[model samples]
Target chain A: MTEHGEQREVFLGRVRAALGHTQTIVPDEPPAVDEALVRLATHDDDLITMFCDRAASVGMHVDRITADELVDQIVAKLVELDAKWIVVGFDSLDQADALNNAIEAADIQIVNWLAGGATMDVQFDTDVGVTDVHAALAETGSLICNVDAKHSRGLSLIPPVHIAIVGARQILPDMLDYFATQHDATGIALPSSQAIISGPSKTADIEGQLVTGVHGPGKVFVYVVEDV
Target chain B: MSASTTSLTLKGHDILFPPLPYDMHARADLATGDDQLQRFINNATLSKDLQRREVCAQTFGDNYDAMRSLAAEIKQHTLDHLDHYLEQFVDAATGTGAHVHFAATAQQANEICVGIAKREKLTQCVKSKSMVTEEMRLVPALVKVGVEVVETDLGEFIIQIDDDAPSHIVAPMIHKDRTAVARAFERELGSPYTENPQELTQIARNHLREKYRTADLGICGANFLVARTGSAVICTNEGNGRLCTSVPRVQVAIVGIEKLVPDMNHLAVLLKLLARSSLGQPITVYNHIMTGPKRKHELDGPEQMHIILVDNGRTEILREETREMLRCIRCGACLNACPVYRKLGGHAYGAVYSGPIGALITPMFKGLDKYPDLPHASSLCGACYEACPVKINIPKYLIQLRAQMVRRRITKWPDRLFYGLWGMSLRHPATYRFGGWVQKQMFRAKARAAGTAGRGDRYTDRGWLSKAPGPLAGWTRARDLPTPPSNSFRYWWKMRS
Candidate 1:
């Protein structure tokens, strides 16, 4: 090992030498990507059914509901968790006004958790988190949420229960499709933080016994709106 | 030992893996003698191996091997163009708001981290599961700097309090049972002893949640680094990883130089393979991609972020014929499939990384002379190759390393002299025939003297050598050795014709 260490130039220079390079030059194009091997679902597949089935398989609760029943179902679920203080990123979701009214009428206080990054104080006090997914993956039943000013990264995490409202139109055939839409012609555009959540937080650390709700939400409820 | 309010808590035993490679056979001997440990590790590895096969088959169907091939090509491509990608990644990450640092050694890596912690005056640290940090032994170094680093991951938390090293890659504590966890918790956290995994998990959760809420610094490891986005991708089943990156004011990710892929499309290919190959999950619970610290107008994220790209001994592997081994994703699939690893477990490998891949790269990362026994640890079994997601071809590299050992005169002289004479005998027909005839007659005479004569397969008469003489004695120490056939292949062919 070196006594102190090398600078970035010196370190990368050693890397170049190790790879049998005489001097730094333009690197060759990356390997040709074959999409046939990666993509699991396609346009022909029923993305909604596939997403629901696959999502349920990984222990997430998935329900197909119309726009009208969204309020009742979410309220019922919140009541089921006995949540008094909840966090909501409803401004980004469809039917945001009605949902907020119903949640407020149900007497659950909304806490702030987004600014200054996943405020553990509020997240720990909040019993449930509600948000809208940027995209829903059919191939693996994953929910993608990108962080923004309106949409906090903590609404789906740091709570005992997570309730997500996914638009049926947002469901993509595969994870590759989500990436295809996320990028422009120039290159892939990634948000500062994008969470692709699939299952409840769990661990098999002690003797390989599966335990749920270790640090993240114990239960994740994904409600797919049919006519959003 | 009697049953009472408190059952016998699992004894506290530290796995004293020395700084460098040591007597592996001695460790294997101790591990093989413990019946409970042997059975536990055997069942766990076997079950995990079965889960990987079934899940891969169900999810990918006939396209499984093709996906592995694609993933392998992507990793191999990145490694071939590592210098270029490294430059690209540094530029992209810096352009986004990440402070990227390079460390040539583990000490340098730790010092860089210590510098960051000291410069910011951050004392309390919350860390997620990171194999790279374990390689750096970052916890102790931070502790030495008066930084109270807390391991927030469940397995690592238990490991930290117990004063132990992780035994497996994904499931770090597969070697220890729940009783051991209960004991560790009761001893360290002053919690009551309970063998229930759920209760023990709750105990750890309650204990670590406080650290997450109060920590000023967060430490994490990368599963993949996307050069195009200049992002670090982490896939974790528990929520601790996300909490580590999101909860603390300052976030740092310690990544190996080998983890870069060109773009998100390439990341998709490898991510599909990593979790399914690891624990039969389609993906982990939280697959969070951090492009940089929290952006402008963003409410939740770290104020400052740093990426430490460590090259402790990787360039050595990169420059050698074993450069292909760097394609590993650290999923631990090869460990579950390796028979020697299944029997002896990871501690016997005597390195930060363990199993078939470890047996190859650990010796290369360190000197082959320091770990000469590791290459010979395998039965040349191809299970590890078959199970690998990135298609490492571990057995081939192991054979290459063994050949290197012989070429370097690392092999003992007595065995070398014996094998050299044995090779000469096989070059000529007369010496080969005489040697075989002499060997067959001696075994036959010995078996008859021992009165252990029996049918080879209930038809042909063959003796069982229950007791052997000289160096051969070790072969029959645990199990009997079967005698050779009555006639050689040449003689049999001549008789048939």
Candidate 2:
């Protein structure tokens, strides 16, 4: 065995010794799903308003609209911002047909951020990037995105401006509610990389002065469609 | 060798405990001299503390304490069953194509990382702000082996360039003003001097952006490791966490074993408190839950992922008395709330971790003999406990550390003698009165001598000792020692009754 492997056994042995456990002790079972849902239900009311208010407070531009109007709103916002090039995740294209059509109709150059699609340079050069949020937290105004083969991480990160389309029904009350929904008795399946983005990139590192657009997107727009 | 070995050398790798470059008093003096830096630390920490209060109240409302209790309980439970959770995490992380390594010491951890870099033939290693990496002192190790490691966080980058240690955990360069940063940048980066924070941040962004593009390795520290999902959750405000994780071909996260949450449910509880307590943000700009390397069909992300679970001295701290220190999420709320830390700054602690938590842990991790002064640094104020998101009773631990110090006879002779005598006298009322009478007489003699020597203060016509003789001189050096009353408090009480 390698030194690290030996160290691993020894470390685990020491941990067991410290805790007075000689053998592997299985953890207690997680709470039931219905119990978790009951706890989640307590914070179910006023989620959209809370999410919008919290999102706006953290420098994210939030707009609520019907699902039918999401494409027009996104296209209009892109035009308003004068974005010439946009990159989008494959998941967004697979999920939102109207959004895809609207991007084509708006005459904006769109790059697909998949493995055989857009390169890192193309994503870096894009003016706007859009992705559909898997879930959102109302209390923190966070948008959750899970990165996989179809949903490239850079689609939402590299652009100067990012437009996240969060379905109103997908918004959870808080991180607890989000986690409760993710848990299962056997195991929780997670993506390679899951991001909980609260707002635009910012830093107070330089003399404690807050500055945005350090490396990631400077402007983040969240379009909350009431219907999915 | 037993795992409880205290030797500085571990597994053919030399664990270093370099002597503090400067004494605490010197750093305190420097902090005092720089009014701007002092004001900056004070304002920044105070503002963060205020914001943390407001946001936590606004978000959790009456459930704030309940959330903290749940977080603490989860941490304690996970720690108790750490072996199971760690094995589970390793299995799940490996199941997702991540290679897991274990390091029993800082040297071993550095060696593991250096070994990876060598195997990959990595040239540039980009890193986000990770206090564990700072504690491991990994950059110098990597640099020693001809691998150029660049700190991508703006504050860490500035301090790294300046060859200075981080003064604050969250804000590494909190002690540095704009002028200092501009000077450092001009001297090091050969950039034109500019004091504007936005411009400075832009310069760093432009510089690091190029490094990110070409860097072959990305290193980070995990804020929390979810056992159920096998993810390393990294939270950051500057988005460096995302860039570091995504841009590099090889990514490594060096996490302390105590950073585990039982599941994502526990992680949710911690996430709520972590940001609010650290920066008063509802949440950081990016909270990336990285499970492993890039998938086979992913466009970008590390092709190889490695998670090094480092023990160093953490396993020692997992003992019953000091286990609470492991609950720290490195949010640095305790540091911001500590009065001693606020006045002296982080460098004064002379450890990678500073502030109240630092004081408590340093003694345990580095041995009470080596860092005996840390336990005495605090005034036993419970502000750190109140501010701690996990609600680690820091003052309680500090008092425990002091008791351990006393029991071990590690305290200085004079201090031990003084406290011992005081304790004995307090046990007996007659002896206490007699000791007070003797103290009063001694003070009267000093006052008479000062008056006769024409050293009386004009304002109150009283003799105040400017400098005291003997062991008490340590107290009187910076302040006057007022004369004690001739009549003892007990005597006065008896007469009145």
Candidate 3:
């Protein structure tokens, strides 16, 4: 390991010791997660069009989804988005395998999310980064991603295009519900940096003119999947 | 910049310097340029005026006022029950393993921050754009104790180089153009003189990159403090806030006592309204929630975290009738929507908080009696009240402050005489009509004489309507006013009838 890597390990070790080996969650069931499909079925065409209209506002696309063929649709959506290079979280290996197979078929590179490594170098060059979300908020149409061993929060943020793959069952109604889930899960322990990304990075600071991709991902893609 | 005389003009009146009976609105007026100031005020007021109307149309439609009232009611509820929510916040934050410190004043807050810095033995501190620090003058205090503080925000960095203050709350250097920034950056950073904004941005990014990595301390301001998670949310367009918080060994968040919200739900609503109100955006470039220092098994984040809840005369403000000023979200809406602000910009206010809000706040912080002149600085247009999201009745507060100044005998004797005389004339109809007629005759006689003499150059006739004399002379120094008609509106209507 490099000097910085060694120092990080020592620091992590100290933090782990300070935490006192408290097991917050027993993991009886895998954490439920979801990516909200805004226009799944809505009578208001204006609302639907507005959703799709802002799709390009943040460099995201509104892909129509069918209840069946969840895996196929997600993989196809990633391919169609022209993402040649991709990153996925450790917890997302099951979906990542299917995605990897599709990418292999298309002759693309798939970078797995590592707890520790030189991921910063690849962040600039990576076309797309994927993460298995903690939960998806339906009210704001937001994706809740946190820093953890499995999630590797950097990938969700650092890449130009972030394609978050989430289970449809994980959708929460609002921030209050999500907070309840977090409290019950961790019993008051907070995540380091909890990012609630509603859309791609945007700004209107200069003369009140809207500009996208100022700092964070220019684009955000959510691929909703069913339970395997 | 040593301790110069505290004596200064406020608005347009002149008074004795040093330990005045009231706040100097005359002093501020003297310091500010009436002509140059008009342009700034017009620009801010007009732009915000149009943008607010546009935003209202797009979102609330006719229900804009209703929504604004609702938002105000919610904020008022939150403020009234602040102690309960704050206790809950402290409980939740401590439960999450983060340390929270309470400070009752700016000195206490600075000491707490400095203590944290001293404990860490930090030499370098990088900061994001935070108005709270500007209020406390945190950088100067920190620098006095030997910490090399660097501001990472682009506008802040530009102002720091020029040794200048923020001219606008949001856009700190709005008065400066691209070429001026390019020159400043080139001279300071020794970078190329690239006039392109993109290049300038890249230069700033490159320059700030090293500071972020090397800095031992990261200081930030909270847009909203979520009481539920014990988290401080910073919303910024630049990635520097993220870098500063993420890379530093120790992260310190300095926030006002009024910044707290009950929970994430309330936080969400404010965030949505904040971006839209300030810049008309769906979101900022970064919305970072740092709950505490790095947790076990976490790779990147500060090892230590501290939150300094600075009261800094805020509680004192709450005790007074000026508690509405605390409701300011620092979105610069008042600044953008103010007529006087667009003309004078922020620097002319001569206080950290500028614009109409500054006019209201400056006096309160330094003692209103010292700044009695500030309250009279406004035309009482009520534009600021219209622009405010929480609906702070600024004009009402201003008028109340003025009344207080007069009651305290802070105003000059001339104003009292003028106002008393003016009030008496209105009370008696005969005297009112007689005074009106005499004033009309004097104005007409002066106009007839000037028109006969100056002919085409009527504007140069200085004493035309300016014969009132004394402190009011400043108004006529720049421009001429039109002559009043010989007959009153009543007389004209009577003649027509």
Candidate 4:
């Protein structure tokens, strides 16, 4: 309920008076923006190279590998992280059964997200978060984390380490494409929360010293699995 | 509003930082005398300014200026028709299962937020970084209502523990160093003191994560509120923004109406410039776009989302003449590029905002008469204008504010009389020439008397005065005044011809 029922009307009235409008007016069209002026990267650029280079520059470790290496790489990476437990966002990957089997054989515990009422508290105890990105951007090397029934918002955050599996086909050239893609995919109905991740959570606040993983993942590793 | 109330602490809880001292001289004296402030703040702002320039130039190359112009145009267009876009936004957001509220003043905004807490029976609150929330003095207000609110941003967390005010818009702790963080943590959080920034950051990270996990309600400020989608886009590098909005049961975003952008494409342009201008990053680490509360099928997110569109004093600024000032994206580029802000630091401005943009708007927000010194704070160097991503002509607006001050008699009569006489002198050739002749003779006489004349430069024998007398003394306080050349330009031109 509104604290004051008429406050909205009163506030809008004042705004209308200030704008000298008898009625609220939306302009016929917004100011025209030149695409050429606003866009930094074009479709002609090699998106894979751009995404890899830009992601690495921002401190995220980016690797390009064939899909054949996907399961082995995932297992090797988990061993390298020394993971006691991992929070998985999606239920399926390329080889879901084989992947779980590999992880179990490697002695890594996968937290059952559905087994608990306090999903977040359980996720907080994990060493890493692993998920497949909705899309990646070449322009800024950002990963688009779209939240839905199949995916959890905290999977890409909360944990100290985030490992994202991005497919080459899912990479977009610019942020403009991400927005455009959303309009086409859902037709104005967006996910509950859409986050664009460019790099690990970092801060330069304490005397301008750069520190990563302050409140989010400190290390972000992106594996761009090649699409066959 | 009383300038002398150092104990602006509300409800016996220190929610607000002590206001900047009313006396400009005292404020400047404190900044100029502090060696730590001189070393850290000066180096940070100067280097950030250079980084901003290099990155923007490197990325945009030739279209940078035009892009800035486009950004300015979009913001201006939005403000011109804010009423319509705001209405559209309210309806669209409401359709997304979000509650929209309106607040006409800062007090009203706080009351509405407190009202939400009472109705929902919420106690623990976590907040991300927001200048608007700072303007509302939200933390202390919530504390007064018995709601424990924790500032989640690393710098803001330290600031809350230390009972200090933020000193920068983006990097709020720019005025402090690792030593201050170490001391604050050791005393307040019971952590062992460590002057290393990396260690200090780790301590804060551990502490803030617990708050993020437990907080029942979250508060945030929006960088841009998209009217078309009924969405609020929050840009943060630390990822706390995601946790604060995601982990809480209820999420409340308090935003000034001026944050509205017409569409998503417009948001893209601003986002491209926001990080580059502020921190030299191509983009912030987390650009979170939230449409509404968790849907029936969504796995995780806040169950309820409330957006309070706070007018505060933005409507007053919307009066066409000052409307362009609202185009500021709050990138802090102006602060980084400002000579005065770099020299004095942010706290000297005596407001939540500081630097060139602050100099223009702070007076307007808190009466020119109350903060009369702010209008004249700059040297009118125009670096701020050059650096503004949205192209706010800060120097031009500052001059207008000074003119307004003179017209309204906010300036002292003596200073007004001096400028007025100086303006009058420039009208006539005879008086102008006469005034110039007198100034030259006096400067030369003073230099000669001080034994600093003509021995200054071997090549030209031009004299310099280490100090000047009377009203001119302030100019020479920090620097020596070069003696006026022997002959007037008019005389020399006449003689040459």
DockQ preference between candidates 1 and 3, better one: 1
Cα lDDT of model 3 by residue, B1-497, tens digit: 11123434222111111343443343345436555345544654567557756865575566666656655655655555555556666677766666777665677668777878876799999998888888777887788888999987777787777665676677676655567778888899899898777667657656765676578999999888876678899888755577677767888888986787765656655665676677555555467888878887766668788777766667656643555677788777788877667655665555667778878987887777666556776888998898787788988988888888888877779988888777889898798998787765666577566563234554433225544345556676775545554446878888997
**lDDT by residue (tens digit), candidate 2, B1-497:** 32223321221112224352213454456666777767888888888888888988876677777777767777888887889999999888888889999888888999899989998899898899888887788998999999998898888898888766687889888888888889988999888999999999888887887888888999999899998778999999888889999988999999999999877867777776788899988678899999889887776789999999988888888877677789999999998888888777876676777899988887777887777778878988799998888789989888888899899998878888988988988898889877787876676577677773335455334456777766788899789887664455766888997
**Error in Å for residue B131 of model 4:** 0.4
Predicted candidate 4 versus true structure: per-residue lDDT over A1-228, tens digit per residue: 478433677888888888889888869899876889877777899999999999999999998988888778988999999998998764646666677788879999887664443277667878988888888899999998888877888889988999998889888898888877765664467887999999999999887878888888999999998772
The prediction achieving the highest lDDT against the true structure is 4
Chain A TM-score, prediction 1: 0.91
Decreasing DockQ order of the candidates: 4, 1, 2, 3
How high is each candidate's interface RMSD, in Å? 2.9, 2.7, 11.8, 1.3
The lDDT per prediction is 0.85, 0.80, 0.65, 0.85
Clashing pairs in 2: none
lDDT of each residue in A1-228, candidate 2, tens digit only: 123434567879888877778987987863222233213334647888889988998999999988777778888998998988888863653347667778888888787655455766567778999888889988678899887667888877888899998888889876777776766535545678989998999999887789998988889999888776
TM-score per prediction, in order, is 0.93, 0.92, 0.78, 0.94
Q: For model 4, what is the error of residue B335's alpha carbon versus the real structure, in angstroms, after optimal superposition?
A: 0.6
What does the lDDT read for residue A137 in candidate 2? 85
Q: Rank the candidates by TM-score, best first.
A: 4, 1, 2, 3
